[model samples]
Target: MATAVFPYLPADELKKAEDESNARELSWFLDNLQEKLAEFKHGLEDCYARLSPLEDPESSTLVISTPKSELVKGHVTRVGTRVVKGSLHLRLKTLPSLHLKLSETSPLILPQLSHLRTLLNNALDCVDITRWTGDRHSAAFITSQLHLLHSLLLEAQNVLTGPSFPVPRPGTPHPLPIASRTSGEDGNEHNPPWYQCIPDPNTFAPPVPENLSLHLIPTTSSLILTIRVLEPTAVPPSAFNKFALAIGAQRRLEHDEMDGVFMWKGEEVKVKEKVRVESGGDPVLLVLGVKLQSLEKGIEGAMMSLRAVMGLSQEKDDD
Candidate 1:
């Protein structure tokens, strides 16, 4: 028999090497876990700050209360070194609620909250990572608690900022200047061509007796007009066959169909043609567009003229 050039390690030595490798991996996992926990803790604090003002009873204007009658309760029990049970109650204002269960055994005793307020206070407090022993069980338990607390804080923030909460009323719409070309023959800043044209609200007429309205939105390159019919009824035999829209004489866009876009000076406006008549319940959506520069050059007068053609505006007879 000849001696082997390479010899296999004994079973005991092999097992020791395997154990050391696992220990190193576990240490890396614990470090990562601590970092994640710290990040979550910071986020929890910020969310709680945003929600705290609404929690004050004196801040009635900003507060939305969930009724006690709506509260739903759930419980989780764990049988381990020592039996532990936890209860959670949720009061939800909207449909669909939340439920949670905890089954893992924790190495350290977990904190208990007497009520929602206590839970929120605890979540807002700094997480003490010094107590974490870098053990897998401790990491799991801490992470789970942080996640639950984060969810609760998020829910509180949502409730505080929800649409049901009262908000300050908005003021009147302010007119914004049309976007102008920065450098062009027509765009001399010192002696710029008169391009500021405001739409005469007087001449602005929507489809009458048909529950139709028109809204204009101005952009950097063009003016967009949206036409909507609030009510759709069956089209009468005398319904207008074609819908025409124009902004500042750049070009007239005529469409007999339900929707189309009109282009002018490289700018486009869109409009919907179909009126929601009784047979067709779909609301008429017509979008139209025109170049912003065209609008600056007294294009509103052209729009008024187009309105007259569509029977949307009547020219006052100069008596």
Candidate 2:
């Protein structure tokens, strides 16, 4: 068979490949819920830099936790892990009576807790991760959903106090900026011949937490990489500079060392990154790592959006 051109794979096949990969990855997370839970628990402790005993309050049992907000916050602890023998320092603001009762004496609710735990574990096991795809957009979607859920769970915990805080006053309803050309979904970075419009030099990323990572490994022909991140509300200024530098360096290397004339901003970065901002705050930064390489023989053309070729299918499937 002739050499296949990089980034020139057919659309249908690319989507299938990405779908399978996403399914497998998600399945892995589900299969080893305990391990993931452990990883998350350790991660939470590390990020929060606090040793508060897993915040178990009375009248309510802590079932599980996930990344709580845009900024990395909490995680779910799986049962069977060594529970520190000492008393946890969880203070219950909602019901001090219940809190004291539970802590002073382990409540009979252990059974209830165990039952809910079993139910949750089973639900995760049978979760229809089919709702997810291997595409960057799908990944972002899942990350966003998880983020929102985390926030809601925390809010619910606080609200159980029965209006301790002032009633929230109604405010102007601001519509989300999806309509603006300025704010686009991270997924649309690969719109074909128009892919130029997608953010190049842009990382294919979900919202990223501080602990999550984005890495790029350059190959003779293409880049290989892994990105584990949570979604961000907006891009930081330093992140923007890093993106500019990486794209510039890559372009210089291609031109100076490899005798290539590829378009860096045009092909390497998404057009959205170049979006002209007319107001508000600086745009939210989403980071993705790109691995680059030259196309091989056989294919007459090569097309790269703001993401890997395998990413094409992911984008489509997400839509």
Error of 1 at 41 (Å): 1.4
For model 2, how does the per-residue alpha-carbon lDDT over 34-97 read when each residue is reduced to its tens digit?
A: 3433443343333222112243321111221112322111111211211121111112111121
- What tens-digit string does per-residue lDDT give for candidate 1 at 1-319? 8784256778898889877876666556555555555655555444333223222321111111122443334332211111133333333332224342222332111111112234345654525532253344453454444444445554333222212211212342222223542111123322222122222233222112223232222111121222332222233222223222233423222223223233212333222231111111101110101111222122234333333432343444221
Backbone clashes in candidate 2 total 28
Candidate 1 segments exceeding 4 Å error: 1-7, 54-118, 129-319
RMSD of 2: 25.7
- TM-score to native of every candidate shown: 0.25, 0.18
Please name the candidate that would achieve the greatest TM-score relative to the true structure. 1
lDDT of 1: 0.31
Alpha carbon lDDT of each predicted model: 0.31, 0.26
